[model samples]
Target: MSPGDGNDDDLYGGTGQTRTRLPDGGQGDMYGGAARRPARSSSRSLITVVGVVVLLVAAIAFANRGNSSSDDGDAKKPDTSPTAPTGTKAVTSGFAHDKQGAQSAAANYAVQLGSAEMFNKAQRDRILQEVITPSRVTGFEDTLDKAYSPEFNTNVGLNKDGSSPQGYTFVSRTTPIGTKATGYSASTANVAVWCSGLLGMAGENSKNPVTNSWFTISMKLEWTGGDWKIVTHSQKDGPAPVPGDERASSSDEIANAVEGYGGFTYAR
Candidate 1:
């Protein structure tokens, strides 16, 4: 399907709340002036996170599979794990304080929770179930549902039911640039994720053309089950650099680009 947009955020009709571009603390531009740029973790939260990780282990399948046996060669498959240390399960557990697992989890969760799919009820529920502490899932659902109200949906040029506009593709993606731990403990860690995002709608004759943005997502993480889970989260604008004199892409081009390019899975 094709996409539509108007970089100016035409969907909100200028309300500037839908698709969340809510004002965050930072120095960067959204559409005009400003610089462009772009969490803590806890314990009961940890248990819940680890528990959820157990449920998703089979689904993620990132664990390293031992190399296949060879008939003549004896060259063992060198370490193939990406971004994980020795003896630690790949992306399933081992989110200890010193290992930076909490930081990685925060980076990955930022991508999932900030995705366009989070606007949909089913996907949102699943995400909350996986990344948020068990005790908070139901509450987060109710709170977030209210946050993405029907009016907010309409402002983003969607139907009141949160369905995409006909022939249009809405985009909301987040990419983590880096992570830093402000605090750590046996069961809790506080980390920061610097991020950039793409938001708005795509297609011909679209009012809100897709636009790029930068921000920071602050997450209060808890040590649940064993891994890190979000206890609270907040956002702020970017520490953006001055804009260059580059011409912006056409709406059609932007739409095509979004449709053609797939997003990354891991954040770090």
Candidate 2:
């Protein structure tokens, strides 16, 4: 059930959807026949939950560290590049034509393909144009068009039109932990990106509250059109770790955190 596999049921297991895990709090199951209202809690509880989340984030950073080597000191050097691409464009391009470039391209492609924007046809097409090889765009589009059907949209707690409900916000984002490039050549490369993602609906009564998952995306990239573009890609679950003891946040708290935080642009 890799991304672009065209099996709607496996969408989340593959790449685009999030598998909802029922928490201690009574949260509804969006696809489990009937929906239940989320349990309510006070802001103090939310603040405590936020503190737990921060700790979990720190743990993730620690887990993602590359293995030590003779160049461990070099690895510890801070990245000088901006956290994001320096432009007003929605997606960045002009990657270097090398292994590092291919890794960067693959990481960014994973983010775009895993984004909530992929649910909307127009935005999806635009993203494909930017990140996918031109010749493969139609094939990818055809696959995703079927994969992101109305029923599929509803199952993920979005409108049939792939829009968020009036009071709900759909969340889909991918953060690359690291990337490795192998089978590199002047014109092509293979890159695998270790990623952590957040996906689901965020609202007071969201049937599917946002949850996180870890997976790796393997991409085949070609240096085409003066930039590295995805020829094809697939995803497999984990490299996931055991759950931490952190308390799950309320739907409102999760929603607020997503809105307050911005994402980074990953590179090797």
Candidate 3:
């Protein structure tokens, strides 16, 4: 549930933090019911398995042959007409005008603040300058600089200087599940973003493994110079669901997923 003042009443309830509980070892690897070992297979059983595999392979090939002609990507193209404007710029001030736009602004800002870029001084400064209001930039920079101290860096498996550790890829990302405008006006807006996040070091046999978390961040946005700019923000524990018993992917898989998938430029 959202961690607001019961703003989105239909969806929220009492909350500190809620998590979907997965099995101890892994979520994906959990076995339902009894665990049983397969019996030794005879030559005939082996032959049967091979036959099944061949049929499955043939079916997969047939499916792939038809997929190219069936262009799902084209069907999923977003509407870019004026009525439903998809903001072209990653961030442009003086553009967002409604509650939807305010939600979009909060979502994008959440992504930027929780990004891996925020760990680096230069990139963090750029993001602050772009996403935050002018009045808050100096204070935000000072607070963040102190919070991302050398000890904090070491704890998160980064170098003392806030750089990614050599031979290791650091991962930090926040993905908004959905957003709500708790309050809105032409000059001011309050938005809450429900988010799922991941943070940790991704490396083969790394000591610090990646972790997933859920939280809600509420931003008080003000119209300054035109676009929505963050004035203040706060986060609270989530309304998590019970985790499933599924096996967690390997470190290599995690790293590959992080590297291969590009993040979206969020819009309402």
Worst 10-residue stretch by lDDT in candidate 2?
51-60
What's the best-to-worst order under lDDT? 2, 3, 1
Better of 1 and 3 by lDDT: 3
Q: Per-residue alpha-carbon lDDT of model 2 for 213-253, expressed as tens digits?
A: 66666777888878898775655556877777566776676
Q: Sorted by TM-score, highest first, which candidate order results?
A: 2, 3, 1
TM-score of each: 0.66, 0.71, 0.67
Across 1-268, the per-residue lDDT of candidate 3 in tens digits comes to 1112222221211133222222233233222234321121121121111110000000000000111232334324323321111222344344458888789788767676666666567766776777677887776666556555677567556798867767676666666789999999999999988876565566664655555656676778888876788776655556555655566666676777766555544433
Candidate 2 accuracy as TM-score:
0.71
Model 3 scores worst on lDDT over the 10 consecutive residues at: 54-63
Task: Return whichever of 1 and 2 wins on lDDT.
Answer: 2
Highest TM-score model number: 2
- Candidate 2: give the clashing pairs: none
Candidate 1 lands at a TM-score of 0.66
Supply the global lDDT for candidate 2.
0.56
lDDT of 3: 0.52
